[model samples]
Target: DVILKCDAYDGFTSNNSDENDNVGNPSLQYDIGINKCWKAVGPAHKQRYLEYTDEHISVKDDPIKTSVKGNNTSNAPKVEQTNNNHPSIVAGKQLSQIQTSLFQSLPFARYLNLITSLGQPLGHHSQTRRFRPGL
Candidate 1:
């Protein structure tokens, strides 16, 4: 089982009214992924895909081929709304407003820091101050 995760910015255009006719910050961001299965299959699991060498089994002779039925795909959870500004909660569990802050949450605002070279840690802005074009 494998879990894939990705993040992307969907909107940042000069045409956007909010951008003031310039490229503005992304209006939408998303993190999407597939969660792995909880069940574990050991090395001996017959249904697991295997690599063979020298005189490998043919497709008809492969074990566990017929046992698999229905969709093998896993259903990923819906994208949690960071705009909600709420800590994550266990499924089927509710939290009082006061207790919610105790849980750690995603820091979506950090994405804004990537917008400018000055905001980066690589010192691009600091180096520019020392530029000596005449030299």
Candidate 2:
């Protein structure tokens, strides 16, 4: 299990709440009952994550509201606003969107390519097609 350490008093605010659950009180601990086997659930979660990042990076067909798109693959997972605290829409997480662009544009592209090829050989991409960077 991963433990997130947050600022003492500030951690309890709604800004720091889990995206799925809006409860901000950090002291209160509860597990979200995702009733699915790990094998079935993990890939779906990973796909959603990949979709979120991809959509924000690709330039969308609009003027004022400049959004991004992925490779526009027909099977790409759709990003949903199921959570009020979704990182894509949250102020604190906006920097992550910028980071994604830099990750692709700068010298990191070679590393990303290498990592993708390595993961493919290990059958890591077998779980989810969303991991395909340009696809």
Candidate 3:
């Protein structure tokens, strides 16, 4: 009985070895062969191609092709005219009574340290000191 050690087995070919063995080994070979499946598919793909954008045959570009844009403008939720403000929410139910201090949810404003804030834990926007670059 004989046992091949380490990489020796890889180098030693046996009767059971693959005929395409070298094709899979990067050190032995790389260019397996020109993919001829494209030959029959090329013309068919070109036929359905969009003018400049993607076409029906998206395989060469994307393994899975899809035509749907999940949340595109067409399917997006419509904007509701509630008490919407640029920097804060409304303290009251209507836009006419907009006030940040009482109604503001300032988490995002505080986290990003934007230029404004209305509530606690004080967030980042409340800082007025800018040019000091230190204080």
Choose 1 or 2, whichever is better by lDDT. Answer: 2
| Per-model RMSD to reference | 24.0, 14.0, 25.1
* After superposition, candidate 2 runs with Cα above 4 Å error: 1-9, 12-26, 29-94, 115-135
Clashing residue pairs for model 3: 110-124
lDDT of candidate 2 over 48-96, digit per residue (tens): 2122222332223312113213333443333221232432234223444
Give the distance in Å from residue 100's predicted Cα in candidate 2 to where it truly belongs: 2.9
Per lDDT, the best of the predicted structures is 2
lDDT of each: 0.23, 0.29, 0.24
State how far residue 18 of model 1 sits from its true place (Å): 26
Predicted candidate 1 versus true structure: per-residue lDDT over 1-135, tens digit per residue = 000111112112234564675655544321111111111122432332112112322323433221222332333122222222122221101222212333222232234355543452332211001111111
Estimate the overall C-alpha local distance difference test score of candidate 2.
0.29
In angstroms, the error of model 3 at 92 is: 9.2
Q: What is the lDDT of residue 31 in candidate 3?
A: 11
Worst 10 residues of 1 by lDDT: 125-134
Which prediction has more favorable TM-score, 1 or 2? 2
TM-score of 1: 0.14
Name the TM-score of candidate 3: 0.12
Per residue, candidate 3 scores C-alpha lDDT tens digits across 1-135 of 111221132233233344446443224211111111111112332322111111223323432221222322342212212122211111111221222443355554465445444333543332111011001
